[model samples]
Target: MSLAGNRATMQSGIGMIEVLVAIVIMVFAMFALISMQIVALRYQKTAHLRSMASQFSADLADRMRGNIRGAHDGAYNLSRQRYPALGDPAPSCPGPGSCTSQELAAKDIHEWRTGLGNAMVGGWGEIAGSVADGFTVKVYFLDMLAAADGATPVARNCQPTAADPVLHREVSCYAAVVSP
Candidate 1:
C-alpha cells in the first residue's frame, strides 16, 4: 500500500480509539452521577424521617405542657378516662377542684390521644392504629433521667402493653408538678 494510504488508515484507527475512549469516559461519568443521585435520595429520606419523628415529639410535648400549665399549682392528673385519650381536658374548668391532680392528668392524656387520633391522617395515622407498628405516649411523674432509672419515685408510668409495638419509641414528658 502507498505510505499515504497506510498513514490514513492508521489515523482512522486512532480516531476510532479516541471515540471509544470518550464513550468510556462518558459512561463512567454517568455512573458516578447515578451513584451520587442515589446517595442524595437516601439522605433526603433519612432527613425526612428524622424531621417527622422530631415533629411528633414536639407536638406531644407542647400539648402536654399546655395541659400541665393550665392545671392549678402544677398539680395535674394523668389518666385514660377522658375522651380523645391523648391528654387534654375539655375547655371547661374543673369545678371546685372536683378531679384530683392524678385523675386530671390521666383524663388529659386520654383526651390528647383522642385528639391526636382525630388529627393524624394518612400513613402515620394508619401505623398508629395498627397493633404491629403503632406507638404510644407515656406520662412519667419523675424527671426524664429518673424515669429511665426505674428507681425514682414516680406518681405513675403509663405504658402500652407488649402486644402494642406501635408505641415502642421511648417517649417521655416531664413537668414541674409545682407551678413556678
Candidate 2:
C-alpha cells in the first residue's frame, strides 16, 4: 500500500479508540452520580428519625419538670420492658378535677405512649431514676442504626457506623437523664 493510504488507516483506528474511551468515562460518571444520590437519601432518612427520637425524649422531660410531686413520688419511673397499653383510657383529670399528681402522671405516660406510637415505627419509651438522684427518659424507635440492644444504657451509642452491612436497622433505646 502507498505511504499516504497506510497513514489514513492508522489515523481512523486512533480516532475510534478515542471515542470508545470517552464513552467508558461517561458511563463511570453516571454511576458515580447515582451512588451519591442513593447515599443522600439514606442520610436524609436518618436525620428525620433522629429528630423524632429527640422530640420524644424532650417531651417526657418537660412533663416531669412540670409535675414535681410525681417526679419525687416515683410515679414517673418506668422501666424499658414496661409499656403502657395502647387502648387504655387516659385518667379522668380535666381542669379543676380532684385527681392527685400521681394519677395525672399515669395519664401523662399513656398519652405520651400514644403519641410515640403514632409518630414513630415500633416506638417504645421509659422513664428511669427519680428526683432524688435525677431522672432518665429513654425513647426507642426504628432507625438506621447498625447496632443496638433493647433498653441500652444512656452511655451506649444509639446509631451504628455505616461501614457495617446493616442498612435500615432499628435502635431500641435513647435516654435523657433530667433533674428537676
Candidate 3:
C-alpha cells in the first residue's frame, strides 16, 4: 500500500479506539450519577420521617402539658394500661379536695393516655405496634414536680416514654409552666 494510505488507515484506527474509550468513561460516569441520586432520595425520605416524628411528638407534649396544668394542685397522673378490647371511660374531675392526691394523679394519667389512644384510633396520631413503619410517642412524668420545692407550683416536667417495640429509641422531653 502507498505510505499515505497506510497512515490514513492508522489514523482511523486510533480515532475508533478513542471513541470507544470515551463511551466507556461516559457509561461509568452515568452509573455514578445514578447511584448518587438514589442515595440522595433515601436521605430525603429519612428526613421526612424524622420531621413527621417531631410533629407528632410536639403535639403529644402540648396536650399533656395542658392536661397537667388543668389538673388540680399541679399534681397529675398517667397510666400505661391498655384495656382488653374496650376503651377506658372519660375522666371526671372530682370536687375540689374530694379525691386523694394519688387518686387524682392516677385519674389525670388515665385521661392523658385515653386522649392519646383516642387520637391514634382517629388516625390523628401514631400508635405503637399498629404498623410496621412509623413512630410512636410514650409519655412519662417526673417522679415529683421540681417546682414543689418553693418554686412555682404551676411548673411541671414531662418526658417521653421509654423505647419499645414499634417506636423509635430516641425520646424528647419538655417542661410546662401552668397558669394559676
Q: Estimate each model's TM-score.
A: 0.41, 0.73, 0.42
Model 3 clashing residue pairs (backbone): 77-105, 77-109, 78-109, 138-161
Tens-place lDDT digits, model 2, residues 1-180: 568767765643457778899999999999999999987887787677668878887887788777778888888876433432367677888774676888878878888888998888757666668788887666766654323434332224433221122322444455567786
Q: Model 1, range 1-180, lDDT digits (tens) per residue? A: 558766655533357778899999999999999999987876675445445434554555454455554343333332323211233345443663786544554455455445444533211210122112222433221123333445322233332322122232222222222211
The candidate with the higher lDDT, 1 or 2, is 2
Among these predicted structures, which one has the highest TM-score?
2
lDDT tens string, model 3, 1-180? 558766655633357778899999999999999999987876674445445435555654454444443343434322343222125464565675675654554465455555544533211222232112222343322212222244321122222233221232222222322221
Local distance difference test, candidate 3: 0.41
Q: Pairing residues by index, what is the TM-score of model 3?
A: 0.42
Q: Which stretches of candidate 2 lie over 4 Å from their true place?
A: 1-14, 83-85, 144-169
Backbone N/Cα/C clashes per model: 31, 0, 4
TM-score of 2: 0.73
Better of 1 and 2 by TM-score: 2
Tell me how far candidate 2 lies from the true structure as C-alpha RMSD in angstroms: 6.0
Return whichever of 1 and 3 wins on lDDT. Answer: 3
Model 1, position 8: C-alpha lDDT score:
57
